[model samples]
Target: MQITQKIPPFLERNLGNVLIIAFLAILYIPILLYWYDGWLNKSINIEHEYFSHALIGFPYATYLIFGKNRHQWQKLPNKNHPLGGFLLALGLAFYITGSAELVAISFPIIITGVMLWLKGMPGLRLNGFPLLLILLATPNSIPYLLTPYTLPLQKFIAAMAGFLLQQLRVNSQVDGIYLYVNNIPVEVAPYCAGLKMLFTSLYVSLLLLHWTGKISDRGRVITLLSGALIISTLANIIRNTLLAVFHGNGQHKAFEILHDGWGGDIYSTGMLIVIIGLNWSLDRFEESSMIISDEKDDNFNE
Candidate 1:
């Protein structure tokens, strides 16, 4: 005799929504109490920097999960798993012992736990990317890690700008993070280290990777992200060089135009376009390679 398993009442109906709402409530109440101050501070800090662009990840993730994966939600099964309880406990422990940043970071784990507890592994797998996107919205306290890299990046940008100026027949000297052009000083500040651009580019790359449905291969995803980082860094160097050259020439208006306002927007828009183009080109190349491989396999069979 064959036996059939019965679908639980909750799983038979709406699978993703109920768990998602419960997960949100679980995360929000604690976050409001523990991490609110840090969250506010981080928001204020990013307001003046390109890090503000990170805010887009939240709504983008929402649309990606609900809008793009509506069918997957219906297919998800509701099953209570012990692993979920373990993860929830682990997240709470981390929150209690750790700093506010840790609490913010724990959101993904806690939410994952809630999903597992309510719907099990299938649901977690289905919504994994969206959960990861939540990290981008979390407050980060990375100054300790960022500080060491800042000076080197500053020096590198200044050196590259000086080299570019020299190529243009301009007499330039690099003094650490400062470039002296025709006896005019231009400092490459920490904010110019391209960290904000790097973060923003990485998030954008992830979004593109998901939207392109190229997230299946771990290797390709890593390659795309590394390329995005390189592109963003190079773009920032070029922008800095241009600003420095304008400053050196005593073109104060040009410097102001590029350093802020519309000029800055143009620079960022150009970088985003380049990143998107490169990712799209790579995706097409991958698809072509796969098609060629399938053809070769058919020829071998014949």
Candidate 2:
């Protein structure tokens, strides 16, 4: 005897939608209960620093995910897997442990489990980068972790600024992280050390690479990210040097303007422009090389 199993037509046809709705519902409760405060705090923290601009990546990621999945949603298979179940349990356990950082970190796992259960591996592949972008919304705290490196960075910036000031015939002396010009002390604060800018630049670089489709190539992606980081650091150093010069020269108004006003905004904007421009140029170069290679192959065949 042979046994046959069948799915009802309605259930089979609407399974994708039903699974998606169920997945969202499953994610909603835990996220709201366990992770909302962390997200709120992240939003609050970005309001007053270089990281403020990185908040844009959240909506951008949402749009990217929606755009990526909009056409494929109906094609997704509705299937449940044992791995998805395990991941879901693990994510919940992390959330229930009441560690805010862990909860924030677990979101992608939870969402991945839902996607895998709903649409299997294909869904996970399609949503991975967008899902990972959620981590960018985690509050920026790398500065605290890199506190050991801050003093050295501050000292370096102060020294460089002092050297530049001396080259310009302005008497300046570097005392640790302080640059004294005409005996006016200019402290190289941690904020001036560019940690915040570095973090923001890295986030923006990743977002750009993902959006531009360059992230598919691991080598190029690493190169682009490294370039972005270097450019950001250099830009910060330049800004800090200029600020030091202004403060050393006893230009209090100029220093304050650059530190906290339109001057600061302009400098940040310029740094971002340079970073984005470099990324665009690198992507174009890659595309051009690919085209040239294809043409060479065609010629060789002919």
Candidate 3:
């Protein structure tokens, strides 16, 4: 009789990765349970799910960018093996919640899991762990490390907006995080911090890079992201100033209504407008550079 040997591949060799993932998975259950309790206790709201909820957009984004290129989502051997077990375990847990919202919310996670099992691409794999941790982590958390950058951006915007108002001789003063104008004070709350727009603009910039295929280098990506961050911060400053101006003119109640309720939607729409304009500007700059490059090459050949 002959004995046959079996071997695991490179991904399996990264046992540390697997162990870290497993540890994260183990941590997620307690986190989710706590978050569920908070939700039941009303300490958290739907907006708290913003970080987790945006994940639903990820699949759509991937589809938009990579669907046309069949090889983009390359499949690896045994990718689907763990998927069945995952669904069986998670599906049963969700069935207990029995809320339409929970089910609807979990649906994206389910699709994300299925897609990952079907394709083991690098970006998708990285996205999977974070999504899974967040799905499992209670309160569907955002990391604290991200807060520093967000806070600074918000303060900077508030300052800039206040300066612009002052420049217009509209009587505005920036006191720490508060913007006082015409005897009305608007606190630069965490919500107005421009974090959402910063992230959204960055995501859009990445999408733009993919579409144009003209700036794939790491340095270029960083430059584009830096531009996005700066532009987003400035745009938010302008937005805050506009809101303050409106509020100063006895539109306080109306602005508050929009700010607390539909503020993100409004800001997002405005950010999209500004980002589109910036994109057009960047396109023109790139075209001019290309023209110059072509002329230089022609002269060199001469």
Candidate 4:
């Protein structure tokens, strides 16, 4: 038997190609401006912020290059179709106003919007892209919508770290943003909260879902997000401890290294590697279980 895949009626009608070209233009033009500004202002550079910022536009670029999910955009109305472009513009505008961090965070939502648009969910999955993008992006950089949660999460994590330190008998106390350990001051700032890693972890989780195509929609989200949260928390603890130790040594080097983007990059990259490894391992186990189940079913039939 020959297997045939279904194409959207709109695509069959030539509407899909038109929309793709138009959206492709829309996405690229603003992205170009975003880059031009970055170059003129020297925000994200080839040396330091090179891969970090370039990776932000990966989802849309990937979708366009492969055209694997282009048909999904056919389901959206004209106004709703290019949702990612609008958010990208908004995010770019925010960046221009001296909000580079927010801009970086906004990339997640924008990318997510583009992904969902390509996937072509029923109803207004367009709106959902922005929301999901925002959810994933919000924690990574500065929070624009739910700014309150940032502080709460930071404090909660810091407190937990302090408790853990005590359990380990390392003599630690939570003093506002400072973790006092044996009269040594350890600062728990926003950067040290592993926000970048948290955001990166979430991105990796989404990438896993898209790549494996093994897990159900619900399972993909639940498992990926659970792993992300766990890994993010662990990364945060490690980052906090590093800060405490480095600061205690009377060396302000970590901040300089972190601010130069190396420390954060190393930590975020490490977290991503671990998360990907976990996803791959779990997927392999799941596949093996399914194969075993299939064999059992065949044996029973025999």
Q: By TM-score, who's the top model here?
A: 1
Per-residue lDDT of candidate 4, residues 124-197 (tens digit): 45334324433542323233333445676678767877877788777668876678766787666654555556
lDDT per residue, candidate 2, 91-146, as tens digits?
A: 88877787755665566678777778777788777777777776555443555566
Clash numbers, per candidate:
0, 0, 2, 1
C-alpha-based local distance difference test score of model 3: 0.61
**Cα-based lDDT for every prediction:** 0.77, 0.72, 0.61, 0.60
Question: Clashes in model 2: which pairs?
Answer: none
Badly placed stretches (over 4 Å) of model 1 are: 1-43, 47-53, 82-103, 106-109, 286-302
Candidate 3 residue lDDT tens string, 1-302: 99986657856664544563464356344545544554334355644543432333344444543455324434344355366448645754664587644544554455455455544445355344334433433232353345555667567778888899988999888887788878888877766776656756776666566556644467657867788888787877877888888787788676876565466466666776666566667778878999999999999999
Q: Cα RMSD (Å) between model 1 and the true structure?
A: 7.2
Better of 3 and 4 by TM-score: 4
Candidate 1 collision pairs: none
Candidate 1 lDDT by residue in tens digits, 12-127: 57556666677567756665433444333443444224445545676776786678776776676668899999988888777777676667667777878877886788878878
**Higher-ranked by TM-score: 1 or 2:** 1
TM-score each candidate: 0.73, 0.72, 0.61, 0.62
**What residue runs in model 2 are displaced by over 4 Å at the alpha carbon?**
1-43, 46-53, 81-109, 260-262, 283-302
Candidate with top lDDT is 1
Give the residue spans of candidate 4 off by over 4 A: 1-66, 70-145, 164-171, 214-216
- Candidate 4 displacement at residue 192 in angstroms: 4.0
